[model samples]
Target: MAVYKVYAPPAPPTGGAASPEHFVFVRESFSWAAFLIPLPWMLYRRLWIVLAFYCLAAVAMALLAGSELAPVSMALGVLTPFVLGFEGNALRGWSLDRRGYTLEGVAEGRRRDDAEIRFFTRWVGGHAAAPQQPTPGPAARTLPITTLRETPTGIVGLFPTAGTQT
Candidate 1:
């Protein structure tokens, strides 16, 4: 996997005090679904517990007007914000913004203490298009490996030069 270290401005210090700190940001990869799916399932699981209220509403609506409207209203009530929240989480690739390092990427699960987030991203043309550069820090270093693989739970590294043909 390729890791680039880029500088970022830190957030304002807490307690209305200023402190000197340097931070770096890195990018992890994700597919489009990284922000979709999972919403309906999570919502559906929670919705089951409220089935009683839905039953009552259905009967009430039937007596006042018609049963059809109850299902529609109930569906909307359960789905609207749930979908919104899920989409928000998916699109917002998980990140760790801290004293001096930031990692942004999509991962199936997170390790404790936000130590690492596993995610997958692909490089075009099956390889980097141009020569890469070493990031400046305490020392400059080159990435000996290139491709990072994604599993349902996290990332697994494969040989940098060993990936499917683009």
Candidate 2:
């Protein structure tokens, strides 16, 4: 299954919980297309800051290697694009975070559309009311906390432990 990290606008125009319509599912994996064409993909995604950094870094690398080791620079030139493929989605997510896009959730399916359908279908099933945007409201800094843990014996859900209080 293709894994996707779902992102939604900080504030939906309609207000309420963000619906599937407002979600952007970015595949959580390396991209061959990004590896082959970093600049084009960066431009298409409108990652201006990342693109600027990438361009400057590439140029600097070239200049530093100019009078030194040509092969090292060539290797770096070839390697950076491949690295971009691995990190492109991560960079995009970072950009989204900076732009105030909330990460609603992570989902998976065979195809992109399938992932969307599954996410919404489950969403609707879980909620008694109609779908609402996920935004809590302006001026509120919050995230819909989901499962992520370190301990091996940890449980899921809000009340994971039923142990006695001190």
Candidate 3:
């Protein structure tokens, strides 16, 4: 099952809540597209800051590859895609946060649409319920308290006695 982080856009300055249609569900999992083609994926997601950092890292790696640190640079180049695949969703979430989106809740399902359906069904149901006052109840009774030993009587694990060597 895939887990998704739900984000709702910021309310308008006129004081109305944002529409439900604008909510974004970001899948919390590795992205194969991000691993294979990170730049285009970031571009599609509008992750400008992450893209900028990725570009800078690419440039730095290229420069290092031409210098004495070629092996290290090559290793980093290979590792970058895996890191992008792992962190792509998280980066997207961070971008949404920066753009004034509030984290609504988490949802889980086999797919994005399924996750959205599950989340919205619960969300709407919760909001539709009316608040009720708590009914008065009988006074609670307190259980009798017991004291515990301040010190151990013996070794508590595999050893049977306190001073016995294992």
- Higher TM-score: candidate 2 or 3? 3
TM-score per prediction, in order, is 0.22, 0.69, 0.75
Model 1 compared with the native: what TM-score?
0.22
Top-lDDT structure, candidate number? 3
Off by over 4 Å in 1: 1-69, 91-110, 117-166
* Model 3, span 26-140: residue lDDT tens: 9999988899999899999999999999999999999999999999999999999999999989999999999999998888999889998888877862232233568656775
Clashing pairs in 3: none
Worst 10 residues of 2 by lDDT: 122-131
Q: Where is model 2 more than 4 Å wrong at Cα?
A: 12-19, 124-166
76-129: candidate 2 lDDT, tens digit per residue = 888898789999999999889898888877778999988887777766522324
In order, the Cα lDDT scores of the candidates are: 0.38, 0.79, 0.86
Ranking by TM-score: 3, 2, 1
Q: Which stretches of candidate 3 lie over 4 Å from their true place?
A: 125-166
